[model samples]
Target: MIQFKNLTLRRGVKELILNATLTLNPGSKAGLTGANGAGKSSLFALLMGQLHADQGEALLPPHWVVAHVAQETPALAVSAIDYVLDGDRELRELEARLAEAERDNDGVAIGHLHAELARIDAWSARSRAARLLSGLGFANDAIEREVASFSGGWRMRLNLAQALMCRSDLLLLDEPTNHLDLETVLWLEDWLKGYPGTLLMISHDRDFLDSVCSHIVELANQTLTLYTGNYSQFETLRAEKLARQQGDFERQQRQIAHLESFITRFKAKATKARQAQSRIKALEKLERIAPAHVHSPFDFHFETPESLPNPLLRLDAISAGYGGKPVLDNLSLSIESGSRIGLLGVNGAGKSTLVKLLAGELAPLRGERIEAQMLKVGYFSQHQLETLREDDTPLGHMQRLAPDAREQVLRTFLGGFNFHGDAALGPVGPMSGGEKARLALALIVWTRPNLLLLDEPTNHLDLEMRHALTLALQDFAGALLVVSHDRSLLEATTDTFWLVGDGAAKPFDGDLEDYRQWRLARQAEALRPSSDDTAAPNRKEQKRQEAELRQRMSQQKKPLLARLAKLEKSIELLTTEKAGLEAFMASEEAYADDNRARLADSAKRQGEASAELERLEEEWLALQEEIEALENGYPQQ
Candidate 1:
């Protein structure tokens, strides 16, 4: 069990949780949610022992084993399964002792270690790791690949897998589904439901929360409120509470106003001075009830497109992919005006490729792509955030897009995206990812395109931003084609779904649940043994083949291992620097009014360092995979 008794947590000058008390019983699965910058991450930090509460007790059982996904994963050359298996610390420690005992020929110690291993079921650990990886969308071959041989997103999945592999009493997952595809999200939901440990996760995916959370813990207004039941239930209960709070607030205001009036008029009279003083004392003692605030800070709507042309874009038997290789082949699809479609696929299944092809960013290798006259396409992707000028402000970006628009007009428009006044004027370099995403969205909405091609548009968005976008999309008159893992957004905004798999894109006949079933069936089919295999390969022959393959792979491993060493050093340095920056930002002096410039500089440097670290890790992965391919006598990609 975990307990926060009158916990007061602060970051710099901002008080996040003030005198908040909550108890999470053992085996409780809760969803922690709040608006962006509402201290959800800070709370996780507190629970993980990375941060101490400013004033009060945050207690967990002394013997409880807590597990959390590491924020950074170095480009390690270890096989993915080994990395995941490392999560079982007890198992690893026991194995180490067993190896030492065997070296020393200590039969007693060896027997004890083997008995302990049996107790923990360590013999099946590898298979367990493989299954965890598979559930997170890793292929069987990928499970044997080096950890360095995966891109950032795949590495995130690996981190998640490692966290899940831990045999612990508590698990803390922050935005666990952010890097996942819809199929993987479904798999994770099912997995979490069966988890026996206490789980606290932070996520903007409402459907994921509703599916897995037994209780909802909301962080708002410097307080922690625990509501029984799922997120939908939390919303209903919160709304009703807010309604009552509003009524109470209004009544309190009237009573206070009357008290003030009585004190003001009668205080000047000599005979009534005693009564006036008594009233003043009463007023001073009155507890103030804060007003109920239900409105989301975000408010915006998509404007009508400049032109509405039927069949805005059409792909005729097109083959789309990178470097002339087709991930989606002979796919004929069309986007008509007012059509709302969601793209569903596993990671690397060409959802983004299809979006790029539709947005005119990719050239079809085999077929014709046709566009209606006066077609205006607005495309939004994670890449759009990178395209933003680091030195330019949000207002500056909008001004360049609409040079004729007035400055005040542009400022007002950006405000709708919550980039108000000084925030809109600040350089984009120091802004958070979610803020950058909002800016990109604002620019897209400003264009009033007849067709929208959004690829994972909700990636860095918070719940409020997601809700706002959902509402805007619902009211959008233009055709929309979206590739997102957010089931709530898909359910609210899209009328149809297209499943992208098996080198083809076709209309999915059912909703998200049906897509989940389709994915499970596909996975089952892939795992099923072939009927053509009449007999198993001879064990000696299989061993000989594996020996030969390993011998060849060992010859090519040296250079990749050297490069990995260098990458590890670079990653460590960058990680340390980033941590120092974070430490400074968390300090009280960093938030001082006079230290604003230094704070901004630290933030910008932190962002640059993180981006560079990601690039280096990605390059490391590519090089490692290339080495693997060469050893196997094949070309990567």
Candidate 2:
């Protein structure tokens, strides 16, 4: 168990946590969340024994082995699997001892060392390391490749794999899903759920937290508060507590009203896909969380597009790749005005390439790309952060973007992204990744793009900024095509899902759940046994197997699809009723001096209808995907 008693943690003269007392019992998985610079990492440091509490103690059992992802991995020529195996300190030490004993011809020492190795199951170390690497999205060949050959993101994953290799009593992970794709994120989430240890994770990814964390510990305002349950549960409980206060009542109501109207809809969306599940849950709880930040530091939204052409862009018979090799062949897709789409595929399946083509950063190797003359793209990707002039202040960057605009106007705009006071005027060289990312987005948004192409836009954003961005995108009156691992954002914003793989880009008929099952089936098939003989099977035997499989699948899908249709129809009817009630409630007539009673009744009915609509929609989407999985299988990427 890890415990902090009267913990007064500080950095320099600035107090972070004051007299905070919290205890995490052994095998209890918890999530630590707070605003950026709110001492989440500092608290982690306290537990790791790297930072001493200013006044009290941060304690762990003396014999407990603690594991955390390394912040940096040195450039090493060793195989990635071997590097991961190095995390097991005891294993490495024992092996070193065994080698020395063998060289010294000490029979007794060698026998004892081998016995210890067997007791610890050291023989399976390589296999365990390999599993971790693969789960983190490293292929078998890549696992055997030199560690230094990989990129920075790959190295970070290697570090994570190494941390997971340790059979520790306590595991600490900070932004563990930072560089992961949706598939890898799901694998990691499932893996963490099954981890038999005390886990404390610091993450801005709400869905990941909900999936793996049993409880949440919130750090804010120099206080540490413990909440039992996942992030959503914590938000609701906290909202209820905050609602009791006079200051938060009105704000809470507004948040609740928004949630009441959309919760059921978002909840339905959550069950539709793996990425959406987290975002949908977060959306449900945002009502409660919104009140906590009534005076939230960030408030921003995209400006309405100048012109929205019917087809914003179009690709015909495209063959796109690099170095004269095509990654996507005969790919054709169209982006229309008011479209909200999320691109989905496995890692290295050319999502980035497709985004690049859409943004006009990469030209198609062979094909025609027809763009609307009025098309104005606001593109954002990780590379944009690198392109920011380090010495320039946020204000300076914006000034250059709009040189003719008034300084006050630019300052006001920057403030919307929370670049206020000295922070806005300070040089960006010292800015953190979150700050840099915000600046990049602020610049892109300032352009008033009619077509937004975002690739992992929330990579370094905290939960608050992400929430703000989600709201902004919701109101964005332009076509949006986003590539992101943040489930909440995708679920809340995207109206459609596009599958980009198999050397083609195509509309995916089903939601995230369907894709997830397809991926799982694909993986299972890949791992399934291969035939020893290449001889063709008898036609009758093959035909019989195929027929039986089809019948079994159809039997399972038929009833589920019927339920799905029933739910969808119920949702549609309720949604239409709710929309009418909501519109009437919002009308000036309802809010007029003489119609207060009517307004109350209308609002109540609208809330009820929305809730029912959400419930049905959620059920429909989940069932629809479940049936789709049986009807449509995923091909290997």
- TM-score per candidate, chains pooled: 0.88, 0.76
Worst 10 residues of 2 by lDDT: 628-637
Off by over 4 Å in 1: 533-574, 578-637
The best candidate in terms of lDDT: 1
TM-score of 2: 0.76
Question: Candidate 1, clashing residue pairs?
Answer: none
lDDT (tens digit, per residue) of candidate 1 on 430-449:
67778888999999999998
